[model samples]
Target: MKRLFILIAVGLMSTAAFSQTKTDGVHIYNPEANAMADLKAATEKAAKANKHVLVQVGGNWCTWCIAFHQLVDTTVVLKQAINENYEYVLVNWDKDHHNDEAMKYLGFPNRFGYPVFVVLDGKGKVLHIENSSYLETDEPGANGKKKVGHDVKKISSFLKGWTVAAVNPETYKSK
Candidate 1:
């Protein structure tokens, strides 16, 4: 009887442990994902599509990261901008998996903070490291009580600025 009880307790504990890893439908970062592999795949896809790679580096544990992702996911303009200009991926960074190799390749974007944006060219070369704070709005959010969301315009502009055509020298040639 004692052994059965112990087994049940252990099962319950394991379930709880696993449940803590997920947020309430806002899990943008996958701790178990191979970020390096994902980034390589994104770069390849971007190259073929003539687009850039937009990597959002943060863990599901970060509230702001979740908020930013929620905004981008629900906003039509933001989604359009991303789809038109870049291949998007979320790289997890947290206590359990810091993704050290990915971080080094991305030029240590975490130095800025959680939810930092790293723009990479088709060849996997780092082009820009954007601190997410710059994309946030000074005014309060929809509830008009909390200043915890990103500005759609700012994010759209950022995405547009890093597109392949925007960076190509020939794009500016007088025709």
Candidate 2:
């Protein structure tokens, strides 16, 4: 009985570590109205804000995608970086199939491999595109320290570089 209780306690504790943090500034929606006007309205808003539209393209059934989703949900740094720079849009391949522009921009998933991730500029232009590169599977007991996908430090570093006043690689080029 003691062993079972301990196991349950550990399981609950483990779950606590991988849950979504409170999102205060994240715009967690896309404008898909099955019509032109609503889509244009959303697009205009994106343009006005100069926000990067991060389209996470995957089927609703993908566990890897779900893990990434959970990681984004749970990691505070990930949320911070994302909330500051981008408007997140979950482009469902199975149900929604709404990322036609992003798919065309990426051409094909070559770098990170499938599960395409697209970053679009304020004008609805493609800035960068990426793919899934899971360091370790999301299975329980998977090494947390070695998990590269949601490493807060690396992600923060990238955000810092991408958003600095004069050295932002996301916008300007040194010539």
TM-score of each: 0.82, 0.55
Candidate 1 weakest lDDT stretch, 10 residues: 19-28
What lDDT tens digits, residue by residue, belong to model 1 across residues 46-153? 999999999999998898898888899899999989998999999999999999999999999999998999999999999999999999877866787757678888
lDDT of 2: 0.55
Off by over 4 Å in 1: 1-25, 140-146
Candidate 1 C-alpha error for residue 99, in Å: 0.4
TM-score of 2: 0.55
- Residue 106 Cα positional deviation in candidate 1, in Å, after optimal superposition: 0.2
The most accurate candidate by TM-score is 1
In order, how many clashes per candidate? 0, 1
CA lDDT scores, all candidates in order:
0.93, 0.55
What shift in Å separates residue 38 of candidate 2 from its native position after superposition?
8.2
lDDT of 2 by residue, 45-156 (tens): 6667755555666654555666577777898888877777767666544445545644455454333543556665666566666645633334334654443344446445
